[model samples]
Target: MAGESTGKKKKTGMKSFIGGTILTDERISRQFPFVVMLAMFGLALIMNRNWSEKTIRQIGDMQKELEALRSEHATISARLMDASRPSEVAKKVNEAGIGLKEPVKPPRKLVVEDN
Candidate 1:
């Protein structure tokens, strides 16, 4: 009777191979593939979020650069407009001692006859 009981115990001790452990359960091994897949999906989502944030930050930096360039252009354009006025040009020309004078008399055009 003891021999029969020992034989039954030995038969029960023969555990089936469960991956990554010495357990006899087949359920965890069957679900391992799905668990790894879910973890990979979660990692991909995190990476995508990080990449999008980086892109958004780059766009913001470019927008700031564009605004600075526009301000510089406006400043240069205003300076050019002020310098191009006739009064400003006359003053600068006189300051430079160029001796330029404004015309005072209305000139007549000569009439030529064509035969």
Candidate 2:
């Protein structure tokens, strides 16, 4: 019995794995499609997370820019209102020495008869 057992060759688990013979097993082949599908799902999940983070960053940047623009607009509007006052206009005109003056008299109204 010892001689017969020694004469027969048996493949060990470690030997078959290291020798790359385990990939040819029927069980591994049957599960190959399921393994590939799982890998694809993992890749898609990672991509989705990356995209969501990028969009959030972009929205934050846009909000900052909008705030800056709003402040600028308010400053410009205030400056325009101050510069358009009658006193401010007259002062600028006098500084330029254009020799133009406000009317001193209240003029009489003219009435014409329609034919």
Candidate 3:
């Protein structure tokens, strides 16, 4: 019974072999791979910064585009507003040869009952 219990404990203790020994070993300093990992992390950080800067530039460009579009919209709206005035509409209708002219009256009619 004692041997069986010891064997079970040994089996349980053997499960943590996923680099724990290499990390805890005193003879090997954890510097070379740590520096490499830090370098990789630093490179990733630099690339992310570059990407964010490009995104910021794109956002700025979009803002400029929006302003230009708004200016065009204002110009068009002003033109439309002017064109909607009664005098301008009448002038344009006259230019297009469409306006109120002389009326053409229809003939009168009479009806009789049929039985």
lDDT of each: 0.81, 0.89, 0.77
The runs of at least 3 residues in candidate 1 whose Cα sits more than 4 Å from the true structure, single-residue gaps closed, are 1-25, 105-115
Clashing pairs in 1: none
Poorest stretch of ten by lDDT in candidate 2: 3-12
lDDT tens per residue, model 3, 5-110 = 4433222234445635554543335576887899999999999999999999999999999999999999999999999997887777778897664336866688
lDDT of 1 by residue, 35-88 (tens): 899999999999999999999999999999999999999999999999999899
The candidate with the higher TM-score, 1 or 2, is: 2
Tens-place lDDT digits, model 2, residues 21-95: 877877677999999999999999999999999999999999999999999999999999999998898889999
Q: Against the hidden true structure, what lDDT does model 1 obtain?
A: 0.81
C-alpha TM-score for every candidate: 0.63, 0.71, 0.59
lDDT, ranked from best to worst: 2, 1, 3
- Model 3 TM: 0.59
* TM-score for candidate 2: 0.71
